[model samples]
Target: MQQCSYCVNFTPAFQIIAMTKPATLKEIARRLNVSVSTVSRALHDHPSIGLRTRTQVHQLAQELNYEPNKTAIFFKQGKTFTIGVILPNLSEEFFSMAITGIEQTALKHSYNVLMGQSHDLPELEKRITATMKDHRVDGLIISLAKDSKDFEHFNQLDKYNIPVVFFDRIPPQKTAHYVSCNLRPGISQAVQFLIKKGHKRIALINGPSSLLATKERMEGYTAALHAKKIKIDMGLVVSTDLSTGGTEDAMKQLLALKNPPTAIITFNDYVALDAIRYARRHNKKINQDLSFVSCANLPITHYLDTPPLASVEQFPREQGEKAMEIMLQLLTRGEELKQKGQFFQTELESRLELIEP
Candidate 1:
């Protein structure tokens, strides 16, 4: 009769066990024959709590899989302990490296990071900014999209006293903290290196004319050519949306010129790759018939059989680290402690490397 009764109670017993919730602080206190306040102070490592009690509390908490209620803590501290990052393209090597730096720095400070990609679209950039604001992130780090002309979306964050730091593709704002690379020197060095390799007719496969990097890079190219007493040919400069097909189109147009360039400088590695493909199709040998150089020396370039002759390193990771550092300082030391419109630039020459042919 008892054996039959055991089977009859099995289903109900399982149901009761399934309904039991996770262990709580009160439950721990009851088990240890102590007051709830005592358990709380012990878990918090309060100075008044005895060392033995704190150790016991920590051990039991771990055993019970206890986790503090972050929502409740947010209410008490008025901070979400989270930072939001908005980038143009997550697939790009530059942004990916930058994210690693930002995440590492954030975790070291016990803060969480939330990321959003705009895919280089203006409207999506606005939506991403709005979503980050809605989540009540303590701060924001952003690299403006290729077509992000309006910055009104960021003004809402200012209304809430939230600080913002820009990195890489920064906007034209005069009152924002920024971390960037000095493009002029890097571009100049790249061009001069190509010239030294005995390539005089140099073409530039640039990105959208609106980008600040594009402007700076163009300045560098022009300056380098001027230093060498070479005439600036507008025909050699082709502006594209930086799409694969756009890059191919730019390459085709350059190669069709009456006197095509013997060397080329691209905006980034992606453009450089497209140029390589185009050159191969036209029976041109990279680093031989046509010297190549570009920015954002992505890791993949090192593994390629025919890598660029040289790549200008932008130090994306350093940019991210600096941006986070500035953000944390603003958060802890207050906005007044930082000068308005303050900007930091990572070292350019250290990042540039000449790939052996």
Candidate 2:
């Protein structure tokens, strides 16, 4: 029984791979005749690990092509060094910009991002969150699903000792950590700008009542109108699901009023585009028969021939970076910071950006 040349050559190579398939910490420990923890400490050059032991471990590690498993290394420290990010829709320019900021900031701290898009569905948002929880992500950053109101999924993270930071679409209840844009200032500014332009009948096409942003828009509208001695008109206000059809319906509602508004303030540029298109479809002259102002200041709006007269710059990317920074602080500054009741919230003021349109 003579063995084939191929079999003889493959046997040793296959055995070598079998021995180091994973090249785990336990394997290294067994080889060095040391405890797993001891080998881990020596690899990290901890002071408790003697210099000779550390040196030998390093030399052996280099010779054996032993790469430290980051998962094991982080597990001992009770961290995954990975954060989860959930967004309403990754296709939106605003959220895409936010992702860029979050990823860049996470990279600076040697962390990885696990991203999920909820597509504005509440159930999808909950599922994504649960999946991330199953993965044991150290922290989570979310721009909530537009339709989500229960918030129980967000609340459950607290029970599991996971820190979550919200940005853009913050919950009305301020119990958890968040970074958000205060839409009042910018909305008021937009209202005043419209008033200055001699548009007395201003309409508000806001989002669903579940959102803090919708409430802020209503507040700013009334506040600005009050400041200018104009009576607030409930008939001029309408709510939208923020879909193209929903925005169109809101525009129709406002336009149907006997005292139709000469100007409209929409939730965001996306909504404004839809509203403007709806008006155009009805033969209304944009910025003339129906002037428009919106929020989000999305970059895609710049390419539109008739963008909003002005938009509120929410600084999505800055908000994202700030949110990530907060998550890092909560994670790195001990568990007490991310405990049951303590919270860190930062709100940036939205600025009304005047556009050529």
Candidate 3:
């Protein structure tokens, strides 16, 4: 492949010194010996501006590197042309893919995204939400922290007319707007696959009970067992705080059961990895004495020696696109949706997929 001339001749940053600030219309007008309004009109090619005036303005703007102030323009239009997005963990592959979709969607609409990570702390989430509100962002897209408890931080955004769109790990019992995965389909597939393989004692390692996602996982796991006429065993289920130690603890509790599970369904790929390590420490072979399945279908799992027999594909990138789409709708509808006391709620199906790469 031939390198572009521009790339080959690019200046080294260390050698480039004393770069000038971007020129403004006033500077261009002064240089062109014209009024600011005349320069603006000429630059915009207004019909009233003559050819000679436009030519001079364009030439001056090019020489001075003059550019319009988009912030001022958006401010005049009662918008910042920016949106806020908060996530629990950016390092997770699922969240990384979600960010990719979010950035792509935001770019299409000519909006900039301001990202924040809560690191799974409610206090940090609260501060980030406050910061977003102060930023006067057009809208917000958030996936709540695992331990997020208070809704007041989010509630205050409503006062500023900032629309909130919750994606994966959405808040429980709130209905303004959200685009999250429906876990039933994927969890059911995992559970049934285990059952078909004669693993009757299937267990689940879930997130903290405080999390709405944990409840969703629980519902899906039991519902799947119920559909197959398998007995629901609370003893087979364990909850973790989503830490490595917590995951190992959950695995220990499950292993100590009078009749330990033959297979396990984990909260996510990370949790599964921790559990697999714990199982190995206890001399349980992966996918033989004990098999596993997980959510998120993180690519890291496929790279491991013994990945899950299968994983629930949450399609986080699609979730981000859907969430951004909903945010756009909310921003467009503005007060109309609020006035009507109506909201936009949608769900993307979670599939049992993503393996054999």
* Best lDDT among the predictions, by candidate number: 2
Q: Lowest-scoring 10 consecutive residues by lDDT in candidate 3?
A: 12-21
What C-alpha root-mean-square deviation, in Å, does candidate 1 show against the real structure? 4.1
Q: How many clashes does each candidate structure show, in the order listed?
A: 0, 0, 0
Candidate 1's error at 307, in angstroms? 1.3
Cα lDDT tens digits, model 2, 1-357, are: 999999899989989888765466777788889998888889888999999889988877776778877776788788888999999999999999999999999999988999999999999999999999999999999998887888898889978778889998988885778999999999999999999999999999999888888898888889999999998889999999989989988988898888899999999998998998999999999998889999999877888888889999999999989999998888887466645557888989998998874
Instruction: Estimate every model's Cα lDDT from 0 to 1.
Output: 0.86, 0.89, 0.88
TM-score of each: 0.86, 0.87, 0.91
lDDT of 1 by residue, 142-247 (tens): 9999977788888778788678888888777676678888788889999899888888899999998768889888999999999999999999999779888898
Candidate 3 TM-score, true structure as reference: 0.91
| Candidate topping TM-score | 3
lDDT (Cα) of model 1 = 0.86
Name the lDDT value of residue 38 in candidate 2.
Answer: 88
Rank candidates by lDDT, best first.
Answer: 2, 3, 1
lDDT of 2 at 320: 89
lDDT of 3 by residue, 251-297 (tens): 99999998999999999989998999999999999999999999999
